[model samples]
Target: MKTSSPNTLTEKLKSRVVLIALFVGSMWAVFFLSVALPFLHLNEHGVVPRSLDGLQGILFAPWLHASVGHIAANTSGLVVLGWLCTWPNIAGFWRATIGAMLGAGLCAWLFGAPYSVHIGASGLVFGYAGHLVARGYYTRNLVSILVALVVVSSYGLSLLFGVLPIYPDVSWQSHVGGVLGGVLAARAGAGAANRVRVR
Candidate 1:
């Protein structure tokens, strides 16, 4: 069997790290640009409840933020949880991200307060947590199970409270939708893997 050489492994790791950095860097870039050009009013592009014009937010909301504190809070979760999702394969990370974005954005659009603009990456963070936990349940693998345990231990409270409407200005709808999307993505990915193995 061919095995990856030390250099090859190092290169692959570096690539993955660079990719994650680029992803996070883009978010920071958008935030900084928005701050520098307030006339752009990027926040207005966020999900607006039940409005035709707001539908665009499903694709844009995750990249937009209302404030520095908002993005700062999401940055840690994205770096950590996003990195975790890359385990085993990078495709899983993209799948989880797309699923989370769609789920979170749609939920925020459908249920957000009238005329309120919902923005931030919190939904993606929640989606990553959901994907990790659900991947364990669906795959029943040791690595996945351990990762899920770690996620639950570290983020169980946030997952629980984030989906609740107790916090004013918080998008609990997006949180709930993100988890649903993540779980669905995990299940679909597991099923595809299973089919491939059976062949």
Candidate 2:
């Protein structure tokens, strides 16, 4: 493992601050819609909402939410996972996002039934969860293991309830799908991290 550069902590911490700002900015924009935008529910539809139609289909869903509570929960999760995965670089950040997208998109297409609408960053969260666990296993990194432990012990594992049909609107398909994507991302990230260190 690489040793931390004490002098670089300032730069790394500054980058982390920027990441926090971005996270807040995104939430603020979405929250604004949920509040000021009376019809915000229009975009709440999963991944461009089948209603929107066309290339817009590619945009991520869960960037919107049904209510303040919804966005609040996702915001918290993103901050926690975002910080954990992207310690001193944007590579992990984008990697996790792509992983989430891949996980959510595939699961929505494969497991999600046609005509059904799925939304929420829960899929992304699951992906982050899977990525953290797998990354830790692949690299034998302490931080990754610690983050995964915290995620499983706290939010990710207990939320299996949300994945079940106990609630009519929950999209377990997205949840499960995101997790699968995260696993793939973790494998890729481990290899990438290793390559970077060697050269």
Candidate 3:
């Protein structure tokens, strides 16, 4: 990969920080509006399994939450892991997010219990975690490996529980799909980055 000068790298890092902040801020803003505008009934926009109408939820579900608590639980993880996903750059982050949203939404739509709605950013959070961990194994980069280690150490145990069906209300299917999507993102991204370096 072409090395960036110190000034350029610093500027890039600053931009990344801004990007993450704006993304998370938007989520919070949406949540606040959902609260302020009860007539909007934004929660109804979440993914409803096995219904044709639910298909649109794939685009909106990640931004909707059942309650303030639901969004609150998702906020910290989304901010931290979301920022990590962007470390390689915004394009990779967008790829990971879109991939996870589609994968997780499709999984829930296909296998989730009928007449159920799934909302929250947990799936995307899982995707970010999975991407961070898998990128190390795929790329064999020291920085990626170190990042993987940190992610594993911080959230590995929770991830195991999150993917299981032990919690009746939780969407384990989304978790599974998120993991697959994240690994796929890591593979594609690492390959692309390596090719760039080779050229």
Query: Which candidate number maximizes TM-score?
Result: 1
Candidate 2 accuracy as lDDT:
0.69
For each candidate, C-alpha RMSD in Å?
A: 1.2, 3.1, 1.7
Candidate numbers sorted by TM-score from highest down? 1, 3, 2
TM-score preference between candidates 2 and 3, better one? 3
lDDT of 3 at 166: 95
Worst 10 residues of 3 by lDDT: 87-96
| Ranking of candidates on lDDT, top first | 1, 3, 2
* Residues 1-199, model 2: lDDT tens digits: 9876987787788888798678657756866866787765545446532344411322447565667777777777777777777853678777877887677766665666556666667777777777777777887878767877787788754457755656667777777777778888888988988998999
**Residue 142 Cα positional deviation in candidate 1, in Å, after optimal superposition:** 0.3
How do the residues 25-143 of candidate 1 rate in per-residue lDDT, one tens digit apiece?
89999999999999999989988989999988888888899888999999999999999998788989999999999999899888889998888889999999999999999999999
Q: Which window of 10 residues has the lowest lDDT sum in candidate 2? A: 49-58
Question: What lDDT does candidate 2 reach at residue 123?
Answer: 76
- Shift in Å, residue 96, candidate 3: 1.2
